[model samples]
Target chain A: MAFEVKDVLIVLPAFNEQASIVHTLNDIDKNVPGANKLVVDDGSTDKTADYARQAGAQVAQLPFNIGVGGAMRFGFRHASRNGYKVVIQLDADGQHDPAYIPELLRNLDQSDLVIGARFAGEGDYEVHGPRKWAMGLLSTVISRSANSKLTDTTSGFRASGPRAIELFAKDYPAEYLGDTVESLVIALKSGLTVSQVPVAMRKRIGGQPSQNAWQSAVFLFRAATALIIAYMRPTDPANEPHGEKS
Target chain B: MTYFIGPILSIALIAIIVTQLMRKRLRERHALWWAIGAITTLFLSIFPGILLNLSSWLGFVAPLNLVLILGLALMLLVNLQHSAELTDLENKVRTLAEEIAELKLEDSIGKVNVSDFPESN
Candidate 1:
C-alpha cells in the first residue's frame, strides 16, 4: 500500500498554543510537505489560528473551547467532507514528532487506525504516580477489547484510515478522555482494526501538561467511568443520532 | 404547621412553573413534569389522610418517609432527564460549530483561488 502525502490530512487540534503553533506547522511542512494540514483552533484566546493560517495550513476556529475531542471531531468531519482518505492527529505542543507520520500511515495498510504508541519500546517517555497505573489499567482493558496487545492506549498521536475516519467523523466522543481511551474502544467495537507503532516522544515546545498530581489521583475514577461508558454505549453509533440534524 | 408548609411549598412550585411558562422561559414539554409533581403534592397536602392510608397500604411506617423518598426519586428522575437533554444539545452545538468552520474555510479558499487567477472574472 503506497500512501501518498496528498491523501492525508494532518489535524492539529490546538488550544491557546500561540507559542508553538508556528513551529509545529513548520515541522509538518519540513517533514511532510504537500500533505493537507488543518489546524482546529479549539476556541483559542491566543493567536494560534492566526499563526496557523500564516504558516499556510487551513485553519478552523471553533466558536468555543470544546476540548481536544471536539476539535478532532471537527477535523474528521472536515476530512470526510473534503474527500481525504487518511487523517493524522498530531499534538499542537510538538511532543509528537512529525517524522513518525509516514510510519503511522504505512501501518494503516494493515489496520483502520494506527496509534503512535510511546511506551512500545520506542520512546524514553516515562510516567509515574497514579497516572502510570491508570494508563496501564486502561491499556490492559482496552487491549483485551481490541484483541491485540497495546502498550500506550492514551497516546494522542495516531492515524486513521478511511473506515475509521468515516466512523469517527460521525460518532467521535467529545467527553473527558473520550478522544483517546474511549475512542479506541468505540473503533474496536465498530469492527475497525487498530494497530500501533513505536514512536519516540519529544519534549513539548511550549505550554504545560494539563495533568497534575491531584488530577492524576482522580484519573483512575474518570478512566474507569469512560471505559465502562464506552463499552456500554450502543455499538451502532448511528442509533444514537450523533449526526442527526435538529 | 406541616399541612400549611406542604400546601405553601406545592403552591410556590406551581406558581413558579406557571410564571416560567407564561414568560416563555420553560418549554411545555419540561414544565409538564413539574406541573404533575406540584399538582400531586397539592392534592396530597389537602387530603393528608389519603397519604397516611396509602403509605400504610404501601408498607411504609411513616407518611413523611414516603413523601421524602418519593420526592428524592422524582428529583433523581428529573436530573437524569436534564443530563440526557444536555448531552443532546452539546452534540447539536458541536455539529453546527464544525459546519460553520468548514464553510468559512471553503469560502476563504474560494476567495483565494479567484484572486490567484486574475483572468477569471
Candidate 2:
C-alpha cells in the first residue's frame, strides 16, 4: 500500500541551529513530499525559528533553550495533538539524510518505532571513535536488558506511529541522551514493535555537535543510570491495557 | 584539643546529611556532580594541607582561599544548571497539560457528534 504523506509529520528539535535549519527544512520539503514539518526552536539565539517558518514549515519557538530532550518532548506533544499518524524526528544539524526518510517510514508499517540505524549496513560511517565505542557499549547493555535487537540506540533519526507517539508524549526522558534507547525500551515494554533501518549519517553542517568529550562522559554516566531506572519503572500509563482509553 | 575533634566530627556529620538531602531533590545529572563536589570539599576540609600543597603546585599565591572559591563556584554552577532544568521541566509540564486539555476537548466533541446521529432501525 502506498503511504499517505498527509499522515506523516517531520519534527526538528533545534537549538542554535540557525545556520542549518533552512537547509534542513528545504531538504526535507524536497525529499519528503507532502509531509508536514514542525520545527521546535529550543530558544535559539539566532533566526532559526524565523528561517524555519519562512521555509514553509510550522514553528514552535520555546521560551528558553531546554536541551534536545525537552525540545523533542514538545515536538512529540505537538505531533500527538495535531493528529499526526506518524512523526519522524530529524536533527536540525543537517546530519540526517532526507532521502532515507521513506525507508524509515516504510518500516513504520511493520513496527511501532523505526530508527535510522547507521551501523546496520555494510558501509563506513564517520562517527567519532569515542562516541562509537560508548554507543556500542550502551546499546549492547540496553539491548540485552530489554531483550531487543538494537544496533544504533543513539541515533536521533526515528519515526514513530500513533502508538509510539502516545507513549512518548506522556513520559519521555527529557535530557541530553536524546530519545534513542529510552523510546525503544518503552516501546518494547508496551508490547509495541520496534525496528531499525540502515541509513548513512553525515557530518554536521555547521556548529559543533553537542557531545564533547566531557559532555559525552557525563551523558554516558547519566544515561546509563536513567536507562537502568527506565528498565525498572513501569511503562507509560498509555502502554497498559487499562490506560489505553486515548 | 580533644574536645575540638568532637565538635568538628558533629559538624561534618551534619554537613554530610544536609548535602545528601539537597542531592535528593536535584536532577540526577546535577546531583552526581554536586555529590562529587561536596565530597571533595569535605575531604579537603578534613585535610587542609592537601589544598595548600596543590595550590603551591598550581602557583597560586594563596591556595586556601582560591581552592575554597573554586569549589564554591563549581557548586554554584551546578546549582544554576539544576535551576534551569527545573524551569524547563515546569514549562514542559505546562505545555503537556494544555495539550491534554485540547485532546480531551476534541475527544468529547467527537463523542457528542457521534451521539447526535439518529437512532438506527
Query: What C-alpha RMSD separates each model from the true structure?
Result: 4.8, 11.5
lDDT of 2: 0.75
Q: Go through the candidates in order and give each one's DockQ.
A: 0.62, 0.05
For candidate 1, the lDDT comes to 0.88
Tell me which residue pairs clash in candidate 1: none
Could you give candidate 2's per-residue lDDT for residues A178-246 as a string of tens digits? 367676677677877777788888888988756677776766677677677767887556577345464
Task: Give the CAPRI rating of model 1.
Answer: medium
TM-score of each: 0.89, 0.66
Let me know the DockQ for model 1.
0.62
Docking class of 2: incorrect
Cα lDDT of model 1 by residue, B1-121, tens digit = 6659989999999999999999999999898878988999999999999999999999998889999998898898889999999999988998888877776777788843434556755
* lDDT, model 1, position B79: 91
Candidate lDDT (C-alpha), each: 0.88, 0.75
Question: How far is B52's C-alpha from truth in model 1 (Å)?
Answer: 1.7
